[model samples]
Target: MSKVTILGGSGAVGSIATETLASSGVFSEITVADINFAAARKLVGKLKGAKLSVAELDAENPHSIRRAIGGSAVVLNCVGPFYKHGPTIMKAVIEAGINYVDVCDDFDATEKLLAMDDKAKKAGVSALIGMGSSPGVANVLVRFCADSLLDQVEAVDIYHAHGGEKIEGAAVVKHRIHSMKVDIPMFLDGKFTTVNLFEDSGKALEEETEFKDVGTYSVYGYPHPETITLPKYLKGVKRVTNLGLVLPPAYAELIKGMVRLDITDEKPIEVQGHKVIPLEFAVAYILSQREKLMKEAGINQPMGCLKIVVKGYKDGGKNTYIFSMSSRGQGMGEGTGIPAAIGAILMGTGKITEKGVLPPEACVNPMDLL
Candidate 1:
């Protein structure tokens, strides 16, 4: 039987990926594995094709992960806070000897996973990492430019914007908080470098980018894996950057405010009679005001855009290619989830023959994914 398991299958991106895989008719069996059994059941009920089953998976437990994904031909990992769970889950998946795909965007996690290339190769498992919006589609677009359009890729700039989703999870908020708290990695002037978004080095890279249907917004340096991974594959590329923002400027500002205030510490603090984790409180408060912030900003529906600009030499002359994927009703979930589903499908179908831990540009064909 062709079986595929989706870890954290009930989440924002995972649900979309589950839906896509269900409708694709690629797998005879699809398992929605998550920590929340009810959410998994609900997500399964909403899917149309594929015999769906729900399994409670405590990602922190390797045995739970193994049991949850056993017998699956492919595993699509959609668990969040990748910096926390990505490397761990990947190790488990690799040990299980299963072909794997994940939308892991954390640079540190990506680095960890990439280091497992030899392990995956030895196990004869094909693992595709960063198969999501920015790193997934963004990486594919740049590869397309290098292969089909440009002679020598000199620079690549990736930008994304989205928000107004119906539900915003704490993990999502925490990921954003974690992003701002770390050093942003970028490839500049033929060298790898890191910049702090709150500092001048990062602010100097910030600029207003106009996404096709998502409107113009100021994008700041993002520490996405693409900045680090793409440089290796895009040989000779002097500059690679990933910049993004969450919609409704106010909402983004609130997140920035919390980070700036230093209230995002993970350690619990006394707040009345009970101990409250500052980061937990910050995420809860940010999500609480999300609705009001969206309404105030006049954002009525989910919207997003992934814009990529590749500049290089075409026939020994300076040339540039710009591509944008945008939609008014769909936002980050679809943007990220669909590609993840596609990656799983490719792996399941044996379209991706490489046996190693690799990035999207290295494994996925732009045309095939598109």
Candidate 2:
């Protein structure tokens, strides 16, 4: 009878994770903790056959996180904009002596969490960071190839994209813009290299990747955790790159426009005798346009793919292995939440036996997870 606590459990990914884990019947109790307690309560009402509770949790505040995770065996964090809430909540989880898992996609946050490995190990708590689709499954695929399919891994390419629904969260949009602005890191020429988003520095390995049901679209490099973590984990891996694209040319244009305008800045600017942040304004504008984009694309539901290509050695010779997972409807929820919930279940069951900060591939067995 393990008790699980989920921070930000009222949100889209969190709600789906809550239901998914409850339906698994592996946990004794599932607590949905969010800043908005009412939302948590509403979600709890819909779950059955599990002991559920709702709690107010401000993930940005250490004290609130400490209070929310009390008496819980494991914590699944679905809070967004990891750059803001990641460190605080992680600290609280470690201090409480509980295993932790999160679906963070931000590279900066992942790097920061990596720095906390010693602390987590000292606390005797296992921390699985970036357990969501792209970083999660993508990393596991690389490990599977390196360990089972490849002898001398030369290069790895990871691609992920979503289509059908225009996500309406300003925070998510702002996070995307922020990712675009930062210099993305990749492993190149047997060394680590940094390139701007859409930059033409990294060597291009043309891949004719096919998703299960979604049609193929060209994928270009995007800075994701796989770019940074794979090299460290996969020996002889010379080049590692990650790419992502959104469906419909119009949405791509919109994101490019937002990036070009430098609207993702967080610094406050004075406008009409008032203070405003450009990033905040950009988020609002993006949210307003989501419905129109979805309607124009005739996307009432979402579908996407996370594909990984590993080129190296098999049976002591050159070979290539492609691993892909295609998901439909509830793009963010299913794609992200399912993996997060599975990570939580694994942590609770001691399937993930590592006691340090780690990415999914470093800590999980791909075959077991699949």
Top candidate when judged by lDDT against the true structure:
1
Model 1 ranges off by over 4 Å:
none
Tens-place lDDT per residue, model 1, 38-82, is: 999998987788899999999999999999999999999999889
Per-model TM values vs. the true structure: 0.99, 0.95
lDDT of 1 at 66: 96
Clashing pairs in 2: none
Error of 1 at 7 (Å): 0.5
Error of 2 at 364 (Å): 0.8
Q: Please, what's the RMSD in Å of model 1? A: 0.9
lDDT tens readout by residue for model 2, 1-370? 8899999897877888899999999899999999889989988998897799999988778888888889999999989888778888898899889999999888888899999999999999999999888888788878877777777899998888786653446556766776777888888889998886655653253344566667767665676788888888888789988887776546766876888788768899999999999888877887677767867977678888888888997777889888778877657677888899999988888899999999987899888787
lDDT of 1 at 161: 94
TM-score of 2: 0.95
